[model samples]
Target: MTDYKLTEYSHKAGCGCKIAPADLEKILSQRSGTSFKELLVGNNSNDDAAVWDLGTGMSVINTVDFFMPIVNDAYDFGRIASANAISDIYAMGGKPIFANALLGWPMETLPLELAGKVMDGARKICEDAGIPIAGGHSIDSKEPLFGLTVTGLVRTENLKRNNTPEIGDVLILTKQLGTGILGTAIKRKAAKEEHAKAAIDSMCKLNSVGAALSQITEVHALTDVTGFGLLGHLMELCSNQVSAEIVWSQVPSFPFLDEYLALNIMPDNTTRNWNSHELKVDGLIDLKAFQVLNDPQTSGGLLISVAPSKVNEVMALLNADGLNHAAIIGAILPKQSKTVLIK
Candidate 1:
């Protein structure tokens, strides 16, 4: 049975319901920008968070992420949403110390206790992260929305960015993909109970283990794969100096991917992700293989680039901590016009 008495709504759910890619592109193209440098990190590349240099060893990483209900249960939705927001801080190799709530509630429709459960869920997760939910603002809205604005601290030298993948660095993903697809399936009432549970577990899982890897000093770059999917995140890592080759068979995913594909439960973001790639994806072993690359993830795992020699050691550490999903999905290739090829 569902947990909330949510009314019929007009808009789509979560940030996943964002404007279509082509329309959004046209809008962003007309916007002018400067003084972005003051922001240590911003949404320029659709990254998970923003950062600002605070001078000395201190820097403030600020990110505000909010979305509608991804799960049927109000408390679980809140927990997953909070975990998704806090992940941005961990992605930057920083520890979150504080967070403020961002909410859009329709109290006239949904029960207040349901909202209380949301706060309780957020509070529990914050307690685990050792961060306080200081305070926040809310407004009545047509649809439900909730998330957090988090603040974290990282040393200058330890700040990790998505754009810094070094040539020859191996790509490591800490969590499996296909959550967005499965979530969509849940909304459509086509998802199996076990599959939906697995996807929810992945989305709610924290990236703190990956963040702790910064102590190794050899992990080159770090970023969480969320709305952008794996391919989009890889493109953000690629530049004139770096190219990549990801093994399709080697990429980890939820066991139900083939089953879900058979059901045609794919989300709208999947095609949008594939269309974002101008360069052709070569060595396409299977169409479904390529399609998985565009499967939008929610609160997905950290995609890390590390020195080849250090790969085994890092994997050993992650595995020792029971992070078996942390595996080398691909390796950085020599500079090429096409940033990625799936084999």
Candidate 2:
């Protein structure tokens, strides 16, 4: 057996390698010539995945996600990446039927055996999700990458979206934040054992609960927090005629984040995320809160907006399902020119 440090070969870790929001918008904006009426959810909405209305009470959801390794262990990286990819389906309140793997490997630098380990890890997660890896594509690259293109089914009425939050709806975050900060610290060899374990556990956990919540009528909007961080994704939910009020104290986060923030060990994506919409954000956002808000997450958690009356029920369900870190973080509010208000 050979010891391999996967994160060393990559310049950026996990979702932090995503294109900047501004750059992504610019690229997406260039494609203005196409439109499809059957597409219930498309690039126009910034939703998690593209959903095609089957017109028979069911919709098909498709999403693809890939990223560089955030951890040294090939198995952990594969598990995290696979969970992150399928999360888009769950975010839309869909059940994954199957998936196809996407692999990018540095064949000249790394052995094929490590790639097999990655595939094995992905297969395990798929099995946990009760889906199969039908097939996939691979490519020779400079850095290792693994993910999935998942196909899922959702009842038309059960579909959830990011942009339809009703006012007075309470926000729920399923997992604790701070993966990006911890990943950065880990890369720098500054993270503690406890912090690393917490991050890895959170990253590998699936957001399948989002699918269950989708069946609840009170659950209005849903989104999985990923490389964009909680605030970035919440902003998506607040886009257009909606705004959000986030209670700083109520937000759930990893316990060791204060130590990492003090050391100024944060991911580079934090700034990029903030720069993308800082002007649209109101309220007091200080240095520490800024880092926490914009810190990218790998397979983070689902941010759910449920009716205030059902908040307790939703929280209880999440807790009963072993998602104890779930917390009522904020509420949707009427638009006030700003998309998000942190207090």
Candidate 3:
């Protein structure tokens, strides 16, 4: 064939390869029990990134995300992968200062030139975020993989956590859903260029708005959607006292996604996610709708919780940051029988 397809080398599709949430929970249940005073955020609550206080007004944020190829193009794969990784830094209300390349390639099966293209893609995105790819580790592997480990800085007061949303906070999603579905379609070579571009463009777009949202006092919590999908990540925002409601009409979704859903094209992670945490969701209206909600997002949007009075302010920022499609999907409320209900 005309050159090799990068997607053909990987068995998994981008963030869809993430471990099932329930299994992940069990794996994380036990910890080393070591503690550090400077550690402001740890793995205890599944927050976006680890924050280390420097004994000043600011904190250092660290997060690394890597995944298998989600697209057929090597450069796009790198761009999307890197964007997905750096997103974690922004999810924590911090500005990325630097990044490191994490690459895994099967040298025997793929050309080294493709891997170089992947690196170029990641470097460009890091530059877009005003950061440098200082260094990282690489290994030979069976599948093609690429991403970044990003470090950022945020004022201690502006640091956001996924589990800290308040009951009265309104929820905002800064991007549309359905990358997982489109990713599956692309992998199968069944996707049109237009549809594929939508997914890739969304994935390549940075959630840099997260850094700006940090300065607002009304914004209560923040996290970027990835393998877990919107529902899974939203569940992380819930506590015994906090729950959420999602209005489907207000939730943004990618174009042509319904067509693919009609074709029954979706990542395996969709069902894995729903089965892992379906008990926590109520108001089941549509199965397909739920699929989109449960779809694993590679470089997805930022899920924001803000005080009701400041929704306008947040909307203004999102619009200014070229995220005009971002919408107020629902609200955070006191815990009900289920943590999240879709209407």
Candidate 4:
């Protein structure tokens, strides 16, 4: 067994062991009276990255993401986690400029060598993204934890917003769904090496492709799917004037995911997300049908909304560059009372 530091054990890791959904709801609801500022992108909309206008030509994009070891390999885990965090920058049509490490290590249980591997993995990803690791802070805890606080630069003209999904837009998702379910399976030893490897590769893949998306003026809005899952993120895109229809069959999914679901290995968050949006999705489709679709993602792909006429060109660009998993998943429609529909 490993050795690690001791802390007052209320929870195992930082943010990984998030407070229960019910508790979080109650807490957030109690603070609904807070006011918003012109430049502040507050929690009200569940935005992926916060934007701060610096001045004339540029803006600052800030986001922080952290989680526990979804896989056992320290180096691989760090690479995936760092990629996941940096994805937010690209999702918002920004270039990551620098990153600061966020870590919680069990100094008494886990060896420093393992922690070093984690940083090494993160460093490699930073190198790939053309970003720098400026500096960071760490804590001693009962469980190993790792992630990054990334800052990116966005020109005023290039920034993407999650709330700007337009009615004439088409939806595209860059990678397959089911990482969360597959990850749960791995933790339970119910998945094979191939399945685990697929999930790892997807999680470690960067969103530099999304930067190309910014050049397409018709690409209206974007966000990266992670902990909350696709349905959760889609609900945030819905507005009184615009809604979305998801072609469930067109969505890319993992190879053995159907088999895993057949074996009942879906993660609990999948259902939690559905229940949270049950009101918005009531008659749009059978809620019971999507336990696999709504599964939480770890470093998932960009979910972009582009002008319907531009879909082919976008797909062609992604394909020519070897982004084989990229596909047009749905279209934005004139808003209906239901907000979202799955066909």
- Give each model's whole-structure lDDT: 0.78, 0.90, 0.91, 0.78
lDDT of 4 by residue, 1-343 (tens): 3532212222322222343344567778854665634355656656778887777778888999888877777888789889999999998888999999998888876778888989999999999999989999999977777889999988878888777888878999988888888777766668799988988888888988777888889989988877667877787776437888888878888867777777888766777766777677633454334765667888988898999888988888777756689988888888877777888
Residue range with the least summed lDDT across 10 consecutive positions in model 2: 29-38
- Candidate 3: worst 10 consecutive residues by lDDT? 1-10
Better-scoring candidate (lDDT), 1 or 3: 3
**TM-score of every model versus the real structure:** 0.92, 0.98, 0.98, 0.90
lDDT of 2 by residue, 1-343 (tens): 7688898889999999888787788889866657888899887779999999998999999999999999888988899999999999999999999999999999999999999999999998899899999999999999998999999999999999988899999999999999999999888888898889889999888888877898799999999999888888987898869899998888899987989889889999999998988888987547877888889999999999999888888887899878999998889999887889999
Task: Spell out the clash pairs found in candidate 4.
Answer: 3-108, 3-109, 3-110, 4-108, 4-109, 5-108
Residue 129, candidate 4: Cα error in Å is 0.5
Q: Clashes in candidate 4: how many?
A: 6
lDDT of 1 by residue, 164-229 (tens): 877889999988888877877777777788887888777777778755776667788888888767
How would you encode candidate 3's per-residue C-alpha lDDT over 134-244 as one tens digit per residue? 999999999998888889999999999888898888999999999999999998999999989988988999999999999998798999999999999988988537889
Report the CA-based lDDT of candidate 2 relative to the real structure: 0.90
lDDT of 4 at 44: 67
Give the backbone clash total of model 3.
0
Stretches of candidate 2 exceeding 4 Å from the true structure: none
lDDT score at residue 39, model 4, on the 0-100 scale: 53
Which stretches of model 1 miss by more than 4 angstroms? 1-11, 19-26, 30-38, 43-46, 278-280
